[model samples]
Target: MIRKTSLIAVGVVAALGISLWGGSAMAQGDSYTIKFGNVISAGDTQNQGYALFADLVKERSDGRIKVQVYPDSQLGGEREMIEATQFGDIEMTAPSVGVLANFDKSLEVFDFPFIFEDAETAYKVLDSELGDEMLAGLQNSGLIALGWGENGFRNLAMVKGTVKTPDEMKGIKLRTMQVPMHIAYWRSIGAAPTPMPFPEVFTSLQQGVVDGVENPYELLYSAKFTEPAHYLTETRHIYDPEVILISKDFFEGLSAEDQKIIQGAADEMVAKIRSLKATISDEIRAKIVAAGGTVTDLTDAERQQWIDSAIPFYKENASKVDTEKLKAILEAAGNTTYLEAIQ
Candidate 1:
């Protein structure tokens, strides 16, 4: 009788252990939602690129996690969404690094005018150890930096006229990304650059609030800025990186496995987004011309003039922010550029 009773107790304990184990597993597999927002249209490159991340996360987690994309400022502007993500109101957001500098001043290094001579050079810089270090800096500021994406190179599109020289931009009221570096560059070149959110730019331009706007050709065309600012100048000035960011609060709550999935997907999406951006510029410029936009390709001399003009900007801003780090980034660019890379 004692032997039989002991066996029964063991069976009961085993069943209880299985039930508890199943319950813990189920709790971990419980469904969750991530709100992903951005400041671009649904079909734009950045949005399409972000879809890769969302898809990967869901696939890797087998639907335990879902990311709902809110494009066209359905949530809010870049800065607003970033703050929301910081506070855990939103799960993820991608914004031009230009605007992100406001949250972490260290990012301002990317804002230096005429910094990247070409997309290839920009790519090298972004994929380097220094770039990785810079991306990691966001964690200290309450955000998780997933990987680098593209904003492409910024160009000038104006309502008043085509800008072949900095003198042409003088006294022209222009709209700029709510990025301090962009505003400072425009101001240095003698244009009245107003900082505004992406959503407000279209209406603001229509109302004559600003005479011109600056962005990559893909953006200027897709955002339909080419509709109002019909003249597109191929300045290729600042090649800005876009950042895939998530709320540290939300990220902390996630299982380590999910975190790995999210970041891995982001890495893949970065490559996809940048590749698409590389080929889209020419195609989009054609679309702009077809849509009654006047396109101006700058001469080598004119481009050099723009480069030389930025020296003053570099001098003034480097000391104002993280000068040592900024100098390190600039040195990396100078040393690793294709010309120097070949030499």
Candidate 2:
């Protein structure tokens, strides 16, 4: 009778152990670590926003999901990180729409110069049904688009002097991203566009390898390009909006609750980024002048001329990518002149 009781007791304990182990294993399976990579520098508005996203995800998930952020190209350049995200090598990345245009040619519409006259107009198009369709289209490319983040506007920072008009841009060896449209636009305006990596920009400016570089004021000042290329123009030529992306495969594998947590956190992150960017350009513009850099604003006529200069580019490249999407964006932005011209 003792032996029988001992065997029954052992069976009860074994069953309890099995139940406890199964519960623990299920909990472990629910937890996930997400790796997010970007080229934005640490402590920049974008990274600060990303940090908030990580915190929110962790809090919302009750510590079941953790986001590990790698900024300043710690993972790699924007293009490299994007490919990594697509392949599930990294879970997330935010890349400028220009670089990402290479992946989804439909995005090339945003890369066109002088497309958005102001941030408000850009936001209207981006938050519209049109934008949702574009974001949804990324699933075909193995990416889950979270939302649009700001890169502000692109302005010319020249070593020689302020370039207030397209005529002034003539023959200037300007540093450009290796993006074909940007290069083509610069060339059409008579500037010799020198395509090179971001790391080499400062040295190129200092050594006279390139006469100037173009980026937003924040990037120009933060990279110290303003020190070398002191002439800053408010070209506002390109309203760069970065897209936050996640790996489609990895995202699909997550629990539906976890997916909701990520999407909620990402929406908040994008809002934070846009809010920070609203005043960042003015703040950075002041800083550039304080450090003895020249900031030039285009007059009414000059701004008009700049807009007209892009007419030729629009005529040449409109049909090359997504013409319908391009037409839609131009029409939505109240650029009827460009819309008519392209048609």
lDDT of 2 at 249: 62
lDDT for model 2 comes to 0.84
* Model 1 segments more than 4 A misplaced: 1-27, 335-343
Candidate 2 Cα errors over 4 Å, as ranges: 1-29
TM-score of each: 0.88, 0.90
In candidate 1, position 199 carries an lDDT of 84
What local lDDT score does residue 281 receive in model 2, on the 0 to 100 scale?
89
- Output the TM-score of candidate 2: 0.90
215-246 in candidate 2: lDDT tens per residue? Answer: 88888888889888999889899998999998
Candidate 2 deviation (Cα RMSD): 10.6
